[model samples]
Target: MIDNQLGIRKPRGLTAALSILTTYTPGGGRVPYEDEVGSDGLLRYKFQGNPQHYTNAGLRAAFREGVPLIWFFGIQQGVYLPFFPVWIVGVEAEQSQVAVALDEAQRSLPIGGVSSEIERRYSLGITRRRLHQPVFRQRVIQAYESACAMCRLRHRSLLDAAHIIPDRDTRGVPAIANGVSLCKIHHAAYDENILGIRPDYVVEVRADILREIDGPMLKHGLQELHHHALALPRRRADQPDPVLLEERYDRFRTAS
Candidate 1:
């Protein structure tokens, strides 16, 4: 933290003394002490090595005053997902760690720690999705250059990261390879099985839908995409997993 510029940041000359911002980069180069949010939906932010350090004092003050801070989670170089208003709920001197909560509900939890694995998971399942979706969307959207895989719609507001295998599935993960960038319409359609993407990168409209009479959106936006090749990321690592794509395609086939 001393040498590396990113970590807990405390604004100088503040009245109550506060660490206003912090940053986390998943799998980015190592840090002396890592700040992590586990499946329990609690973030453990380790203070500076010295408990009496100014930064540590600032963090403690933030907790004491019930103040919130920004957590900038790095997605790529110069790209970050900013999670704001995260509260410092507790400070553990033994570990020199502060308990950070991403939302109000999390702030209300037993910040010392939630012991039972099942209970912790149950409480945080929804919270996990809240954290997962934004990061997943950013990563997937960037991978596809912010365009729909089928239609190539370039509007950032209209785009979404559709999971190839859903978050509920055991095989699903927030990894870029498990997501496909699509516009809102196509995302909903993919989720509803109105359309599917084959492992070979082909887009397919449901047979029944293709046979139906509908508006221009049905014709130009969807039907026209049938048999068309899926738009893929240039980076080989970011390309959709063929196995996951096939698995979802099977469900779409059955639904068809």
Candidate 2:
């Protein structure tokens, strides 16, 4: 809906995918351009924009309440070029609004400096990667608030945003409700199928593994987590989707 205010009209599929991605990484800048010929004989527009200018005020407000940056790109074409969406990556020169700069590498090459093909590739890759990173990390962190859901540990550096649903299954898009923040040890345990979380936010430890005669590793590492409630976000809106939690829990319960 906000896109409408900005006069950006994107295809449904592209918009849905971009929404999932921007929910994570949110500080990339964007540039608007009129069709101009580059030295390389290819028609490519330079990107220029200040990331700070493009940040959503509402989202920033959410960030103040502990929500992470969730930036997105909205493209509007001039008379000659068609409008399409692209993700903003790095800001150029740290400007406060959108700014444009020529691609030096593209300007140096033999084919008149610009590679139309490469530009297209860059457009898609930047958008995709930026979007995925935040969503994936935020979802996991939201569930546990960068603390280990199992052990209730709260070291930012030591915690990992773990995905309950694999990225591959979701086309590499990290949905917030599909993640949980865990410590490195716990993340590995969850990934390795040694531990799991229930839909009701309860911890689940593998019985056979816990009963093994190995050192107190299993007992101390996992059994201690049983019956513990997950560390949740301070704000209800920051919580991961209940449906996603249920789906992951169902699969994990069956496997256990």
lDDT by residue (148-254, candidate 2, tens digit) is: 77787888788887777776563223544456778899989888777877777777787777667766776787778877787776655445556766777677677
TM-score of each: 0.80, 0.50
What residue runs in model 1 are displaced by over 4 Å at the alpha carbon?
1-4, 14-36, 46-57, 92-96, 112-126
Tens digits of per-residue lDDT, candidate 1, 183-238, equal 99999999999999899989999998899898998899889989999989988878
Alpha-carbon lDDT of model 2: 0.47
Candidate 1, residue 53: how far the Cα is off, in Å: 5.3
Give the alpha-carbon lDDT of every model.
Answer: 0.75, 0.47
